[model samples]
Target: MAETIEEIASRVRELRELSKVTAEEMAEYLKVPLETYCCYEEGKTDIPASKLFEIGQRLDVDMNLLLTGEEARMRIFTVTRKGEGVEVERRRQYRYQNLAGKFLSKKAEFFTVTIDPMKEKPTAYSHPGQEFDYVLEGSLKFYIHDHEIILDEGDSILFDSSYRHAMEAKNGRPAKMLVVVI
Candidate 1:
């Protein structure tokens, strides 16, 4: 069975308890309000991918442990067949399929992202890493800080994820891209 948001939240809570960390500490680490962090822990709100990543990192565990409840045992290489990667439902407008979720000690996280068409660009988010996005289908409006760039099929970009960034599907259609977070 696929992992549910509540199940992930329960795992996070259990891990936090085992690590002897307090909810207040996690909220401060994520730079989010106490209420917002509590909602994530309670599974009352969807947790952003970046925040989840941060939590996994701070807890000294791979994101696979958080997402799948399974430690990565593949040290050589793990191949995820087409349409076979793990899906992350972190946001309403974005759908992410994790490509290398089982790879141990990966320097980066690989994901295939699908962006649903929307009239307005959502709020930008930042994380402590670099990001690369390669457009595979349709068009995407990419925003990095004050700059906005339209990426068509086959186009790609690299930027610092620590800077505020957002992505929006264009032309009343969905967009697909390969994203690498390092």
Candidate 2:
């Protein structure tokens, strides 16, 4: 079914709550006031398309998935051409609300994320879970528990998510990483 703006807003709110991010925190992340962010969630204020996309990225969900309940699933295949290659195909599922709710429902949760280099620093995702992040591509710097770690491709780290954490590309290049919560 085609989704409406209201549905998208509601889902955004759901995901935000599931992420255990308070409205005040979100407001700070968005560089807006708490009441303004609250209005955006309540649908009292219309979110610009650009800002909407930003929010989706921050939440690590496809903009479409947030607009619609349907998830984005794809089969990605990779092949190397140097004769020392293997064909690798994997199914990836991007479920915005579903995954958010799953993590929120659990005492501990995990996430896999990709950040666009053009965007601002990602808002911190916090909860009672322990989180591990492994950099897959590009460079990223993580701010966790008031400490900063610059991660290059293939670098990995683990920490408690209950403490504040945020991430940004260190070299102005897009970053890809896997986050596991437990």
Candidate 3:
């Protein structure tokens, strides 16, 4: 079974408490509303992978701890078998499978993202650093700021993640892509 959002949220709350960090402090650090952080702890809302990574950094824990409830001790190399990667549910239409969740002190976060088609427009999000996305299957409608780009399988793009960006599935089907954030 894929990892549920509730389980991840619970781990977030637990780690925050163990670290003795207040919700207000986390909210301030994330630059999000206090209620938003509270919702994340309460499992009332799905937490973005980027936000979870930020939490891991701020809480001085590895992202694997938050995603798998297990610490990554290997600094050399780690391999996640096919169909065994940690699944992260960031939104109803977005499913992310962490490709390097077991490697310690990762300088970059990698994921295989599966995006389902939506009737409504997707919300764009921004974070510090840069992002590279390569379409693996199907097609995607990608938006960066006010520019829109259509990417088919085998196409790739790299951009500053600070700009608001979002992606939607094309042809009313699910799309898959490889995403690396650094």
Clash counts for the predictions, in order = 0, 2, 0
lDDT of 2 by residue, 1-182 (tens): 32455666798899989888887877787666888888888977755433454576577776545655545453342222322211111112111112232111233323346556644455554554466778878898788877888999999998876687777776666677766556
Model 3 root mean square deviation, Cα atoms: 1.3
Error of 1 at 138 (Å): 0.9
TM-score of each: 0.97, 0.48, 0.95
List runs of model 1 lying over 4 Å from the truth.
none
Q: What is the C-alpha lDDT of each candidate?
A: 0.89, 0.59, 0.90
Model 1 worst lDDT window (10 residues): 1-10
Candidate 3 stretches greater than 4 Å from native:
none
For 55-155, candidate 1 gives per-residue lDDT tens digits of 98889888888888988888899999998888888888998888888989988889999999976767789888899999999998998999999999999
Candidate 1 is scored at a TM of 0.97
For TM-score, candidate 1 versus 3, the one ahead is 1
Among all candidates shown, the one with the greatest TM-score: 1
Whole-model lDDT, model 2: 0.59
Best by the lDDT measure: 3
